[model samples]
Target: MDNDRAFMLSHTFLLKSVKPFGEGLWQPGASGAPWRSDAAEPTADDCVCSIAIFTEEPGTIDLDGTSVSLSKGSAIQLRSGGRFSVQSGSGSATGRLAGWLVEFFVFRFGDSRPIAGGFPLLPYHQEIAVHPFAALCSVVDRITRTADGYDDPTALRKQAALLELLALLMENQQRSHMLDNAAAAVKRAISYVRDHYTEPLTVEQLASIAGVGRWQFSELFRRLTGKRPLDYINTIRLNRAKELLLLTDDPLREIAQSVGFRDEYYFNRKFSRMFGCAPKSFARSGKTAASRQPLLPAAKQARVRSSLTGEPSRLVVCGGILGDVLSLGVKPLGAELAVMGRQVVYRDKLAGILDVGIGGDADTIAALQPDLVLLEKEGVAASHFQSAAAPVVSFRRTEDVTVRLRAIAALLGAEREADEWIARHEDAASSMWNRLRSRIGTGETATVLVQIGVQLFVMGNRGLAATLYHPRGFSSSEGAAKLAEGSERFREITAEQLPGYDGDRLFLLFSGDERSKREARQLTETSAWQSLHAFRSGNIHMTEAKWNYDDSLTRGQLLPVLPHILSSRI
Candidate 1:
C-alpha cells in the first residue's frame, strides 16, 4: 500500500570467470565453470545474495534440502546462508548446463535517497515467460559483453544493463503481486456479502472490504460470479425471499425488510421479474401445495456450527457428498444440485443453499470463505479446494455409506449425531427386513441389473446393491459377488452371462431415457432373461433407475420404500 518506496539493484557483479570479492560496483569476476555436476556449484553466504538463470536442459536445485526443478527460462533468487547444490547429468541432449549467475544487493529509495531494504528474493523456482526471459537474457548479454574492461564507460555500460534487468524483475513482481491481490480482494468482498446480506451494503463499501478501488473490485467480482456486485446481491436477496415465501407466513412487507429489500414495491418488482409472479401470488401457490401436504420433510432447523466459533460454520459441498453431510444434520452453505441425470432425493431440503455447479472451483469456493469444504473424490481435485484457503476433507463416493457419514460428521464436529443417526437407521432397516421375512426369506440371493441403452451392467458393491446386500437381509449371487471383487462399482456383461448372475430375487433398473427403457423391455423378452429363476418365479422388482446412490440420505429414504417395492411384487 505504500507508494514512497521503489526497488533497485545495486553492487552488481557477473560471476562468469572467478568468484567475485569486495563491493565492486561493476566488476566482472574471474573465470568460473557454470553450475553442473562436474563444476563447483554456488553456495549461499551470509553476506551476499544472487540470482541464477538457466537456459539449457534443466536439473534440480537442492536449496536447504528441498529439491526444486529448474526449467529453461526460469530463475532462482538465493537468500543468504542457505545450502545450494545442483543435481547434474540428466534432462539435456548435450548433457551440459548453461546458466548465468548474477550477484547483487537490493536497495529501496527512501526519503529521496537509497536505503538498504535487505536482499529481496523472488520465489524459489519462478519461471520467466518467453518475452521477459528474452529481455532479461539480452540485458545479461549486454552486461557480460561490456564488463570485460574496467574503464569508466565500460562500467557505466554494465551498470545500465544491470539497471534494466532490475527494472524487468521489479515490474514482473508488481504485476504478479497485483493479480494475487485482486483475487484475495474479490474473495474477501464476496464473503462479506454472504455473512452480512441483511444489512445495508454499497459497492464502495464492498470495494473497501476488498481493499481495492470500486472499478477494480467490480471487474474482479463479475469475473468470478458472472454478475455485477449489485446483481449478485439481488440474487442472494431474492433467493432468501423465496425460502421465506414457503417456510413462513410473514407479510410481503415484513419478508422484504427481513431480507434487506428497501420496501415491498422494489421486492415485488424484482420477485415478479425473477420468478414470473408477484410475491403474494408465489406465497399463495406454496400455501396451496402445503395444504395438500408438506412438500418435503421440514429442513433440520438447528444449523451445524464450529465449536470454536459457536456461530454456524459456513460450509461448501463440492461433490456428490452433499447427501452425506445433509444426513449428518448439517445443511451446507452450498452444494452441487444433482449428478448422473437425477436430482438428489432430498432436493427440497436444499432451500437457501447455493448451487455451486456440478464440481466447484477455487474462485467460487474461495469467495464463500467457508470454514470447511466437503469434497467427493471423483470428478473433483482436492488441491483445487485447498487453494480456496479453507480446510478440505475428501471422501470416495463409493465408500461405505456409514464410513462416509462418520467422516463428514467428524469434519463438521457432529460425531454424536452421526452415531445416533446410524443406530436409528440400523434399527429401521432391521424392522423393515423383519416384516418382509414372511414373503422373502433371509439368505436368499439377489442381483441388481441395470440397462442403459444397449449396455447392461451388474451393480456390484455400489448403489442399490449396497442397500440390498445386508447380513440379515439378502446376499449377492455367486457371480455378482465375483464381479464385486473388482474395484469398479459395476461390471458390464452380455445377456448370455445374465443367467450366471441370476439370483432368487432380482431388482431390474433401467435408465429413464426412452431408448434405454425400450432396451430394458427387449431384454426382458429374451429367452436369456425369461429362463432366470427370479424372473420365472415373479421375484423381479422394477424400480426407478436413478435411485442408485448409497449415500446415507438415499439409504434412509429407501428403507421404508424397499418393503413396499417387495410387497407390491408379491
Candidate 2:
C-alpha cells in the first residue's frame, strides 16, 4: 500500500537510437568485442540485460541448431543464456563485414527475469530502417550527454532520464507488436465482437472465428489479453449502448434490443451499473440540456464569417508532447479548428512526428496562411514562436476531466460549453473520487506504473481527480524532478539496465503485436511480478490503445467504465 511503490509501478520509459549501424554485418559481441561463434554460451551467472541493433549481411544464423537467414532491417535479440551464431556470407566471404552495431544494455538490480519465451526483446522493422533508427540514436545521444554532464552521476536527474527511456522502449515494442498481429485470428475475434456486438454472439461462434475450440480460445484470449472473451464482449456492447444513449433519441427498449440486451429492465440495470445512471435518465437529462442551450448569437455568427473571409487570425497551441498533436483525434481537431477559425496554426509534435521531418516546417505553415501557431513549450524553442503573428497559449495535459475540457474550451472560444461539459463530467468523476477516498483513509496508498515503451514517465496525481479520493494521498515520482533533457524521440535500453520498480499496482500500455503480448504475458508470469503487492492483489490493468490515445467523444464513451475497472481491483 506504499504510495511511492504504487507510483513507481505506474511509470514507464522509452529509448530510441539516433545512429543505427549500417546493414550487412554480423552481430558484434559486447562493446569492443568481436564475433566468436565458437565461444561457450553465457550461463545464468554471467547473464545480464543487453539490447543490440545489428544489420545482417545476407547470411544465416544458427538458432539452437536451426538455420534461419535474416534480412536487412531485421532486429534480433540475444538473451542472457540463449546463444545464436551468425556467419557473414552465403558461401565463402568472411573477413571484416560492412555495417554498424549499436548495443544497449539494461541492468535491473535485485530479482529480475526475462519475458516472452526467454527472448524478452525483439527487433522493430520499418520499411525504411533509416528513420526509426535515426530517431533512436538521437534519443540515446541526448540522454547520454545529459547523464554525463550531471554533477552527480547517480543523481535523481539521471534516474528520471533512464526511467523515461525505459517507458518509451516498452511502449514502442508493444505498439509494433499490436500492429503486426492486427490481422491474427485472435484480433479477428476482437473485430468481430466490435462489429457484431448488437447481435447475439456465443463463445462457440467467437471461437470459430478465432479458429480454436471454445474452451481453448477462451483460455488463450484471457491469458494474452487479461480479460475473458465474454467479459470483453459485454464491455463492447455496453460501450455501444452508452454511445447510442448519448447520441441518439431512440427509446429505451429499442436501444436495449439494438445492443443485444433481451429486456429493457435488464439493460437499465446494467447501464446504471456501468454508467452510474439509468439510460432513460441520462438521455432525458442530456436532451433537456441541449434543448435549453441557445444557438450562436447573430453578432458571433457574423464575426465567425468575417474571420473566415478577411485576414485570418493565427491560433497557437503550446505545452503538449509531439504524439498529442499527431494522434488521429488531435490531427483532425487541428484541421477542423483551423478551417472554422480561418488562421495559421502551430502544434506540438508527439511520438514519431519529430523524426518524420515535420517539426518546424516554415513552408508548410506558410502554405496554410495561418496567423497563429501552436507548439509545445518544452519541445519547441522561443525562436520557433517568434515568427507567428497570433497569440500563443500554453497548456498542460492531464487526466483531470475538468482541466482538459477547460483547456480545449479556452482554445476554441467555447468556454461556456466547456463549463457545461465539465459539470456533467464532474458529477461522475466526483462520485467515484468520494468512493476511492473513503477506501484509502490515511492508510498506505498503492504505487502504480504506466508503461509507454522504453521511457518511464510518471502520471501526475495532483491533476488527476481519482487520486484525490485516496485519503492516504498519492504523488508522482517524477513530480519534483527536472524534465529529462532530450530530443523528442525513442531511446534505447538493454534489459539488464532496467531499474527495479516493484509496486503495489501495475498498469501496462503495450504498443506492439502478438509478440509484445507474449512478452507482456511472460513478464506477468515471472516470479518477479508475483512478488509484487499489485500482482498478488491482482491490481494490474491493461488499457486499450484507442482509449488511451484517442481524445474525441469516443473517449467520453469509455470514461465512465474506467472507475469500475480500476476500483474492482481494490
Best by TM-score: 1
TM-score of each: 0.44, 0.33
Query: Backbone clashes in each candidate structure, one number apiece?
Result: 5, 96
Q: What would the per-residue lDDT of candidate 2 be over residues 1-570, giving only the tens digit for each residue? A: 265345345432222222333333333232323223435533332333334333434433445565443343333444443444555433223533423233333333332321222223334222112225555444444454533353754344444554554444555666655534532676668667766888888889988888776776786565444358877677666766765664457788888898898888887888888656788776665332222232234465345324432222333233333222222123311232322121111223222222112344544444444444444333455355454433343332322334344444434455566544534443344444433342232333333333444434333332121332232233222311111112112223333322343344555544435655455566657565566665776666654333333232333344555544454332
- Put down candidate 1 lDDT per residue, 90-140, tens digits, no spaces: 322232445666665433323322122224535544544334567866876
**lDDT per prediction?**
0.65, 0.43
* Consecutive 10-residue window with the lowest summed lDDT within model 1: 18-27
User: How many steric clashes does model 2 contain?
Assistant: 96
Give the poorly placed runs of model 2, Cα more than 4 Å off: 1-360, 385-388, 396-408, 432-444, 452-503, 545-558, 567-570
